[model samples]
Target: MEDRKVIIETGWNLDNSYANLPKLFFSKQVPTPVDSPKLIILNDHLAAYLGLNVQSLQKSDGVAVLAGNQIPKGALPIAQAYAGHQFGHFTMLGDGRALLLGEQITPRGDRVDIQLKGSGRTPYSRGGDGKAALGPMLREYIISEAMYALGIPTTRSLAVVTTGESVFREAELPGAVLTRVAASHLRVGTFQYAAEWGTVEELRALADYALKRHFLDGDGTENRYLFLLQEVIKRQAALIAKWQQVGFIHGVMNTDNVTISGETIDYGPCAFMDTYDPATVFSSIDMKGRYAYGNQPYIAGWNLVRFAETLLPLIDDNKEKAAQLAESAIGEFMQLYHSNWLSGMRTKLGIFNEEAEDKILIENLLSIMHKYGADYTNTFRALTFDDFTDMALFDTESFAEWHEKWQERLGRQEESKDSYHELMKSSNPEIIPRNHRVEEALEAAEKKGDYSVMEKLLDVLSNPYAHSNEQAGYVALPEKSTCPYRTFCGT
Candidate 1:
């Protein structure tokens, strides 16, 4: 592919800090140029965070750079090497369709990696096309931003650009590139690569790099590898707890998809539950209920075990001692996860102080919700309503009994009714990027070439806790589809 070059713009600074690590950690690869580049959506809020000027990013030269048609100066592009347990099966996989365009230093002295998802193939292409469809790219942009707004740690989308080319998927689809900004692209799988393929020295170097970038306090620890494992455990535990509180199913909990930074990555085949079924599995690829709604915490711990294994050679020369230490750390995951989950549930129920019976109160409500097939988001939101007299809902008698107990419990607390109302509203979002709504947006874009639906959906999701009369329809549950709700990886 010939390079149609353009003069580089100003105020762009790229730092190849990760490149200082051993070359075995990553392979150099430039983004394959696209046919015609056009800007689709640029996240101005995220651009400012990276010290990028939105006005400059809208220019023709900027679009070229964003679409992976032109590589900016000082950018050391590389396709990272990693191995992940895809669906519980270990496989060697790298950046099959992405390129890390080095790290960008923000004005606040913070470091963030700017990577191109859908950038062309390299040594890790593995016989797959290194292109992305516009729908999936937009799906990521929308959902990542929504996650950010919901106060979850996540990789943010900086921009999305159309390549003006067609890619073969279920059929031919328009190609696009998503500019992904993350704290760092380092995953547990990166360490897995060093452990299995590279030398122990390489593994130690990768651990040191991760410590400096993500866990700085680990630098002073006598056993940084153990400390690093502990830190990752803490983050993953809290992260999964938050996911459970919000009714989010990652749909895929592969080791490679889990991030050491604790931020949620890889939005593929992810969705919030419409009905409160703990066994709900949305990802089309998750044939087994392995990564279902109820299995996130267990799967997170399972992924961390893989990560802990990668560090065993570094923890201590005594493999048994290392294994014992790792097991102890892994044990803490469930304890921390349950603590966080309980606290979140308490807040959702407007309980500021602890009560011995709080767990039963929360679980009883969930049990009734499950028995009735209640809409998860709406069910929580309905708790804020002053009137709960609806009789037509499933398991109404059970829910009413539970509600009476909940009110009696709340009466014991010192909070005023208004205070409780405010807390419930803040804790429970009135809306989520519902599965049907997401499909509607994608269908509008793919079949009709209309992006207004996406734009409107993003607006509604931006302030999910706030009530908007015009956007009330977004809060309603979708009519049951003839086919079951299923999400795809779009790879």
Candidate 2:
């Protein structure tokens, strides 16, 4: 390993707005270090974007910085407070296993938070170890990078450093901390935390700050806060639609996991589908399927309602008036989500116009896919290549019938075949972070200390829509026997 030291200049104009609130809002502390720190994965591209020296970061000093063994100058580590409704039940929660070191303004004028996940326990650890296992750390690194490459708004992994130690979960697993960068870590649950504690003033302050930072157009108006709420709803609707279009199941859609900035925050128990079953779920803790593939839109709407309720007191002085205002904002979520979803589906099917029967044709195709168990990513990917010959993948002839109907729908469009084909290829991806591939990579890293698998997967996923004979295996769906790989929380 290299021995160069990383020079970090963290002039974090601490903007400690939430922290300036009552002491009860958050716990002031520093991160606890792991037994031994080892560099596992380094996101050199992100480091360069943040103006950090990539060559220096691949050294022992880099390992120390990422492993929480040393807090860089000007860094303030603190755990944020929040409340969440996990799996349909409301509860108080916080950054139980994560710490927000501080925020850095990038060279591009974007404010990004640098946080240490799996840093040892804080007051909010809730009697559990605040550390993360290696498997989950690797999982987040793989999937989040893939999401970024797919053009989804998401938190990007800056680095993954392994603690040369083991943590006990079902068994002893290697420990790790993921350096995550995001626009902000503020979530809907942060508002709920204020409301639950009866800190109405802090709630209002949070709303105002969030508006200025994220929804600047809604500033200085009488109904600015309400307008901000509406803006968040719109962004969230579009984000969830994007998720559905790609067959992503968030596994855990708790309000705490919903970022106010509309970027996908937590990667816990999340998975991309192999088969086209809308009811698919791979989160080991999600036994009830509340956040299944098909249920994401509805669940996102529900979470937005929770957010609206938290903001009700700040929206208006009159309780009834506040309730009405919040309700109206919440109601718009479904319409916005559906509009984006339908438009994306049309592109996937190569339809440009709003034909009256477009929806029915799309619905029937999904119905056929659900019945026959077609591979979600592969099915759409094959359509882009004009290869509908692999009908056996769907397990029935009904899929072929639906394919004919799909072709008929495409024929109604005015674009030429080549143009339509190019459009489809652009809209559909030839690569996704398949669960089996992720698992295989993790196994190699843990057992053989090899990172070749991870490096190859990242290269392929970075341009998911491109065709490459060298990456043909990556485009194929995992075998049926490997179809139901389960993901864990890595707590």
Tell me the deviation in Å of residue 178 in model 2.
0.6
lDDT of each: 0.88, 0.84
| For model 2, the run of ten residues with the poorest summed lDDT | 9-18
Estimate, for each residue in 1-491, the C-alpha lDDT of model 1 and write its tens digit: 99995553545789999999999989999899999998978888788878887888899878888998888878999999999999999989999999999899888999999999998888888999988999889999988988887778899999999999998998999999999999998998888888999999999999999999999998789899999999999999999998999899988889889999999999989999988899999999898899999999999999999999999999999999999999999889999999999999998888889988899899998998888778887788778765443323433678778888999999999999899888888888877888888889988987898889988998899888886775678876777778778888877
Tell me model 1's lDDT, rounded to 2 decimals.
0.88
Give the clashing residue pairs of candidate 2, or none. none
Per-residue CA lDDT of model 2 for 1-491, tens digit only, reads 89996475423333344455566667887888777898888887888788666766666766787888887655778898889999989999998888887776667777678899999898899999899988788889889999998889999998999898888998888889999988888899988888888578877878877886788888666798799789899989999999999998899999999989999988878989877888888899988889899899999999999999988888899999999999988999999998999999888878778988888888987887777677887888877886766656554677767778877877888898888888788889888888888888989887788889988888898788877775788875666683467887777
Off by over 4 Å in 2: 1-22, 393-397
Give the poorly placed runs of model 1, Cα more than 4 Å off.
Answer: 1-10, 387-395
TM-scores of the candidates are 0.96, 0.94
Candidate 1 total steric clashes: 0
The TM-score of predicted model 2 comes to 0.94
